[model samples]
Target chain A: MSEKSPEELYAERVKRVLDVAALRVPDRVPVFGPYQLYPYTFAGVSFKDAMNDYALAREACHKFQDYFQPDLDFGPILAYPAPAMEMLDIKWFRWAGHGLGDHVMYQYIESENMTADEYDEFLYDPSHFMMSKWLPRSFPPLAGLAGWPAVRTFMWFGWTGGYVGLAAPEVQEALRNAAAAGEELGRWFDSIGQYADETKAKGNPQAYAGFDWPPFDIIGDTLRGTREILADMRRRPDKLHDALEIATKIFVEYGSGAAGAELPLCWIWMHKGTRNFMSDAQFGEFYWPYLRKGMLALIDQGIIPVVYCEADVESRLEHFADVPPGKVIYHVSTTDMVKAKSVLGGIATIAGNVPNVMLLSGTPDDVREYCKNLIDTVGKGGGFIMDAAVMLDEAKPENLKAMIDFTKEYGVYQ
Target chain B: MKEQLVSAIADMREEEALQLAQQMLDAGEDPQAVLDAGKEAMTVVGDRYEDGEYFLPELIIAGDMLKAIGDMVKPMLQAQASQTEPLGKIVLGTVAGDIHDLGKDVVGFMLDISNFEVHDLGVDVPPEKFIQAIQEVNPEVVGLSGFLTLAFDQMRVTIEAIKEAGLRDSVKIMIGGAIMDDSAAQYIGADAYGPDATAAVKLAKSWTGGK
Candidate 1:
């Protein structure tokens, strides 16, 4: 492995990810994860510091890459800008020292920023409603948006009076802070970009090729709270469907617009479609149609959609058969791996079942045993990517070291 | 007529359920009988949820339908004045430092439909608030809810505060949410943990000595 050139290693790593993504056998199973804020923890930097200090955040990524050296890298980890969150006074996220200790990981506050009664307004003009309604509600700094009707009036025949709102002292101060935050965020991204380059130079291909999500989840996760959306499902199924239609259009437009005609190995974060969240009937009615629309949108653009199901999705297995074979990948955490293999073996690549909880608490021997079982079973038909069930926030570094080590040694195909 | 009311609720016909409930009351049917029918409808809802015939929407709609019936029946029941003891009283909240409340809301709604008097403290509730609510309401069970892993510590802190306040022995403590499990329950010194809302209801029922 050490004899190979960096370019060769980069090509081989990308090939492993793409090969498994296409339901074909690579030389061995690829190991990757959605590691957010974890590298910061691994590098002994508080997430608060990492968010504010681009160098610290980049260093964390470098440290993690150097220590574990997995087949693929989830780049730019821990890029959340502290200044921006503080400037917005955002209620959506709780970073260290906000509501938690300096070392505690960031927590997303999922509340009802959008109530049930606002479906028509949101569906009619999602962009307008999001800017005027959703943003104002989610972020306190943006609450002054009511003072600026330029957004509501369609730029008001190109008038300059709308600038009056920004002249407000608080709004001006907020804008200044926001400009500073944007600069910090840009620097942070640049650091991540540099890290990505360094990882490639070292032969580790960045794993998160791109990101997308299911439409229903896009709304349910960010717009309306879970309870609100579920209640809306029964109370106003028609209005819910109407909103879903708009969301599908918006997601597809955004996904295609950002990626152009094709994207490489797009990661579709799947939530609220799993078995525990909904029944098969509801999954079909409310979740699947819109999800399929978005997935097909990406698939039509020749992008491989690697959908990472957030939780167990045993009952929703048969729905994957509707999608074209080898066009998509299913990544799961708690769903039965063998069942996933049986259901999606030929039609799509099946990745993951490694429990994050076990990694945090289990021994290296346990990690090796589990990886061997997964590679032997789900890895059998050459359509499996060995991965943890969820994003790796914090794990016993040795256990992760053991997992990739075991897979590389044992997961090779003849 | 009562059977029809049950069917309307069981079938998740919200408006129909409300109408049938009102009609039953207007026809001078016992208000207790109307409440019993509503409760039975929730039983069916719970059963369907477990059996996979229903989803969260069904549970929410049924809870709304029952609340509508409850609004009508509760007034008449007050006039009739039987003064029966409630099945149990539960004080619930998302633990301090965590704001996720979807699971807590589901559990609260389920307990409400099942006839448990519930006091929901909403999200980001400090341990002191749980202690204060416990003192004010003297509930049979205290439920700590959160989804973040950090809430595990908050649960332990809250349970410790309850114990420190000398109320631990008087009430059962149950922790639940997306991140909680039996081991979390044990780690936090909670009496039990509910994997989901249905399991929470069953745990509450068992603690209250109710069927």
Candidate 2:
């Protein structure tokens, strides 16, 4: 080969990673994850201990991160405080350390000021607010950031949901405030931005990278729940619309000016359960405008807007058909890989849909075989990345290791 | 920096609401007349949400204007209700270990519009108060809300508490929130799951149907 420049060499190494993304050749599928939380039992540590002791928290996260060696690095910006976990301290919100009770964790709080009439408005709160009080109260997120300075930080910017059924007056305000609070979060992010590049390059540079954060998830979570929001769309249409409007604006601003190249992307936790609740018109009316506007703006910012969407987006792929190639990555959750690959064509990247249940419970051989088959299937068209449908809270550590080993060995073109 | 109420109900022309309320009242409008007019305006806004024309801001403004009118007519509604059964008693709060209240607030407003007497317990409620509230207010229904995955357990505990206390038949419990699914409602022994504010209103209405 002719003498290659340093940029070209770096590109070559990255190509191995991007190749799976490009679907250029059979490549190692990286174990990228979405919405994965720690199981309270793993490492025999509880959520309370992890929240209180940096070492404990770091240890638990590192055990998995090291075992997985996830394709992307740990993002540091996320190291900051969580709002809901602190604001809603009923009983389990405490950090007592050890046992089943200690593993409980929560990040979103109920709204205290809203009434049922304003349910939708509360839902629109920009998914962040009153988080500072909890950040320092429990684990000291700023302190946690200091531990792993190499990973790139990504925040749960916002959630996308349909207003289906409805809720009680008090519950509506609490949920709506979940989104409306995102604007106040700008100040917190401003605090974290101060450390964006200040991290000294440790062995784990992945932990220090800063991503353009989207503030949308305050209302919806893929692994959690949205049945209520979906219901509200149908029962209390007016209020649902009201809340979704504000939720949409905050994220649009987040994906646009506020993000400013923190790698303009959104991680929408679109889980299973109510996929059929809304008609396409409803999807367009309720979900598309905000997603289109926010994602489009992020793309305009020169950063590819990847959507870490869950479930089979294949059926509704047309909803996102307008997104240009390399501009989006919809990580599959419930669909078959090979089929999703064919449907997605070559336009965008497919991050994952690997079932954690199987991997966590299967043998090493089984893990290798399953991944190999998936790589062979979806990896065929290029633009594929191997990952779990979502993060496994209780996935066996050994099986996780097996998945990584298999990917590294067989996922390469060479 | 912002009129919380005005911003909350951005969809209504506050300017119009102000005029409509005054106009309807000036033309020999009683307090009930003004309240009825305000509620009618909100109904239009609610219809828009159902039709998919208006969104949350409009609903909020409608609610905001209604609240403004309610402020003017609270004594009247209260006076009428004192002679009759209270409009409807509602027991509401975020489940224990969960502190988000936005959803509850919206539910609170919807309750008012639908004419249910609301008793808000605030967030981070334990199972005992849910039981205690049921004993005290003897409300027609109880609402349990949790916005985080970490708080689903609270729903379960409270529902069980209501059941264990043998209050399941006396007070119907409704559960709704972002992290909650139908399974949680069933697990918590709730009578129903009002996934949104409107559905919750329907459930609340249906609960008090015969009473």
TM-score of chain B of each: 0.86, 0.79
Q: Which regions of candidate 1 deviate over 4 angstroms? A: A115-117, A147-181, A257-263, B1-4, B19-34, B68-97, B111-146, B149-194, B202-211
- Per-residue lDDT for A1-414 in model 1, tens only? 889999898888877777777777789987777776578778998877877777777778879887877877776554577776787788878888788767666777678877777887887677767766777777776675545444555465644665665577766654565577677667767777788788778887776557777888888888887767877777788988998888888777666643532127677788788766777878899999998988888788777777888777878889976788877888866678998888888898887867665676678998999999999888996988888776776678888889888889999988
* Model 1, C-alpha of A64: deviation from truth (Å): 1.1
Best model per lDDT: 1
Interface CA RMSD, all predictions: 2.9, 8.5
DockQ of each: 0.37, 0.04
Candidate 2, residues A111-196, lDDT tens digits: the string is 22233443532443323222322222223322221122111122242211212112334335444444444543554455444333
C-alpha lDDT of candidate 1 relative to the true structure: 0.79
Clashes of 1: 0
- Cα shift from native, residue A211, model 2 (Å): 2.4
User: Which lDDT tens digits does candidate 1 get at residues B125-202?
Assistant: 988999999999999999889776557667888999999999999899888865456655776789998877888889
Report model 2's interface C-alpha RMSD after superposition on the true interface residues. 8.5
Cα-based TM-score, every candidate: 0.85, 0.57
Worst 10 residues of 2 chain A by lDDT: A143-152
Please state what fraction of the native interface contacts candidate 1 reproduces: 0.38
